[model samples]
Target chain A: MKLSELGEFGLIEIIQSIAEKSQNPRYDSWRRLLVGIGDDTAAWQAGDYIELATTDTLVQGVHFNLNVISWKELGWKALAVNLSDIAAMGGIPVYALLSLALPQDLEVENVTDFCHGLAELANQFEVAIIGGNLASSPDVVITITIIGFSKSNRILKRSTAVPGEQIAVTGFLGLSSAGLKMLQKKTTLDNETTNILRQAHLRPTPRIKEGQLLLQRGVNTAIDISDGLIADLDHICQASKVNAQIKIDRVPVHPLVKVYSLNQGVCRGQLNIIAGLPGSGVIANAD
Target chain B: MKLSELGEFGLIEIIQSIAEKSQNPRYDSWRRLLVGIGDDTAAWQAGDYIELATTDTLVQGVHFNLNVISWKELGWKALAVNLSDIAAMGGIPVYALLSLALPQDLEVENVTDFCHGLAELANQFEVAIIGGNLASSPDVVITITIIGFSKSNRILKRSTAVPGEQIAVTGFLGLSSAGLKMLQKKTTLDNETTNILRQAHLRPTPRIKEGQLLLQRGVNTAIDISDGLIADLDHICQASKVNAQIKIDRVPVHPLVKVYSLNQGVCRGQLNIIAGLPGSGVIANAD
Candidate 1:
């Protein structure tokens, strides 16, 4: 009965069931809903455009450590993760709501630095931080809800992938997980490699443009590789009702992750394919 | 420099400044944005409709005690608070994203109960729980983002109040705070009063229909009295650049709260006029 037994996905299933059953069939908004609950984003029709909504939360000790990640990096990653969800749907993020629970003793600079980092990224994509809530808590918590929109014809969904399509990724994989390992273990690497991996983990660039490009080229299925490569691939497989045959040797592995794996005596593939390890790579399904 | 030293409002000022400074004027969404931070909800033009988005966070211990509040009540309250924000905007809530950080040792029933409570309230308003994120944390953290919309002409904003408008609330005040005190202090009251006060705190109804009616009646300025009467009135005053003179004798107080206050030897007005106590009453500015 413990949450540890049910796990995150299990808990989501329970909540989703309640959500599905709780909806009033007579409600007018149901007419506008395109997708709900089980996807990178919930999407609905908004006149000529399709609106997208997704939310993500980061806990102080569970998601990040203050020692390993800078306050600014924390801010950047929080927004980046939500942006990735929109990117996966081939949507342009338009606005965000940031809710924070901070310890009372924390310094103001930490919050301001976080805002600066978040705003810096928001400015890049032209996304606005519109509204939010702040509360006191024992640990630092940040939850961001991102609202995005796409041209109705161009929006992508994992359920649209055909059986014979090809699966490809936008960027190198495993560097984030490798960087996380290095940071957690304090494994020393060359300055360039450390910066590459750490930045990959801490300051990922959401593939907003790449996703749009994919959709323009008629790719209709895609997801962000935040929950590792295989897990995300499985999401597409389940949603699209298809099977995937992976050529393990062909999987793109970052050279930095390879070096770290070798230095730490861990298999590069473990870093590359395992579940739970996170990355910013975009997995796209194309004809 | 500490968060306590700056307080919530001071920190909000710093964040609002950063958000204002960071927005790119050239972005396309900016042209559609009608309101951003420093409001009850962030709103923008979405085709013929004006879209509204608001987020609220509830932290255990800070917002509620599990010993005093049931998990179902927690769920209802979490969604109700966000719905209150949408109501304050005179918008109909359509969707929500729930982000929860819960202890791993917690029971599955607890989560399901929370979802049931949330879904029950959401069902009443025909709002869908579209998407969300879940994470493990030491404390229970619930953050909900509600998305709503209104006819462009029907939307309300706190800053729209005019100097000659009269300010009045939709319902009695201080019941929630009084109920909270009764529960927290274990005050022994008659069964009827106890039930009334406790329910007021635990299952306070959101004034969604009342808000829509206000908007229908051309009331363009309103806010939920979740931050007590004076503080919320101060928000209206500050945003609209007007002042209010409330007649203390005319402020509506629940008879149950009065009874509880009298029993506890506390002044009823203190409970009614304070800044931090929360209620579900909608304060309206009408001509």
Candidate 2:
């Protein structure tokens, strides 16, 4: 029978039936588990430190368009995005778990390729894919949650940002946004620009190490640039209850973007469109 | 302006605008921030222990059909599924970030309800809605990444089950799947059963406390039951390099599920269809 026929509860029972079979598995130090999978809560001996856990998700049409993005890119981005989160906290990324909702008819090759892309990034990031959950859904949805570790003293939080610290960013901005535009416009470009922008869009390079460096220096408050700088910074500000002023000039934009904007006769405001966060107000300094 | 006009980078810039006007910002004490953003490799701090992270996504057509699920339920589930990941590991959930993609023309109230749902869950779980990205797309997508902390040595991995360990589960299973079936079949149900099944689907509880209990009690290796029992258990077996035997008769199935299945004329595998984890091979006795 179709999944719909089995209904939600039926499907869950099927899932629980199988899930119940997982049993207690893993390392000797953390090995002997009293609670396996049959309870409302679970417990492990954390010892003296706080538990570091992180989760991320990728939607089919939103995060990726199968037609434009390669499985490898999709896989890598999926992992990279999450890794970036751990990095923001001044912590080390250890294990990863993926929850995937895929179209029933997805090809094995597609999945394998996606895995390869995922592995490539995972390996490079030096993190391992411990396990994950897979299910059939109307669309492809990939969600990954990771467990990381850090001392309660060391874990950086947005609430820790103080008033006087200097604001620093690792890489240039606007390239990924530009590349996205290039893709949508289907605009042809010089090999140089095309390669650069496409790479940015398909495989976003998350700032992982920089986060660690900041944390080691004891910069306890941190955040990743998943949302644009303004919005992400807004989070830090809101959490810390502080105010900040950033020069429009200090913010970086790609060279080609300016040229493209000029060529397209787009206003400075339009150029600034790549600067806001979700649910954020209008972009200031459009010029 | 339409999102596309902002170009991907341009849109990000727009979002960044939200973060720009913060009250205070600082970048110091970070000794090893390798690649923060706009770079090839991201390097950050790795203290004495490792870090954990994960991601999950819910889509309009895939995870829920607005016609059946209330906006509140949709929002609740969006965060609930991610929290379930943290509970699966027996970890204490701390912070969460979101990435939502919505089609143009959605009503403001709908968006507010969604946010309300997310905030309520986060508050209830004590998980902070730290930061996330957003975009516009044809389909509505909600992606969330949760960050939590656990002791390094005590962390559980899926590959740790011992040969003789017991397999267990928390709360009832198969209820959501059963609910989905009824919805799809368009079958009528008593208000009581409908409420139970719908609640099962809408606000299925996360096993946070149970997982924590198990973790504290030394349950090291585990994974959540997002997929059916058969599939998730297979992961444990594969990871642990061992086989498990669980009694089908010993398995737990909700009473309401039994009633629904019987009322629906289920037999054999269908007995627990309403809230059953079916097609999962059951071992005679897991002892």
DockQ, each predicted model: 0.84, 0.06
The parts of candidate 2 lying over 4 Å away from their true place are A1-69, A73-106, A114-122, A125-190, A193-287, B1-55, B78-91, B111-128, B144-194, B208-256, B271-287
For residues B202-285, could you state the per-residue lDDT of candidate 1 as single tens digits?
A: 887888888888888877888877777888877877877777666666777777777677779877655655443222223842
TM-score of chain A of 1: 0.94
TM-score of 1: 0.95
lDDT of 1 by residue, A102-206 (tens): 999999999999999999999999998888999999999999999999864567787777766777898888878888888999987889888888899899999
Residue B191's lDDT within candidate 2 is 93
True-structure lDDT of candidate 1: 0.83
Q: Give the clashing pairs for model 1.
A: none
TM-score of chain B of each: 0.94, 0.76
TM-score of each candidate structure, all chains considered together: 0.95, 0.59
lDDT of 1 at A283: 78
Error of 2 at A282 (Å): 21
Runs of candidate 1 with Cα error greater than 4 angstroms are A274-287, B274-287
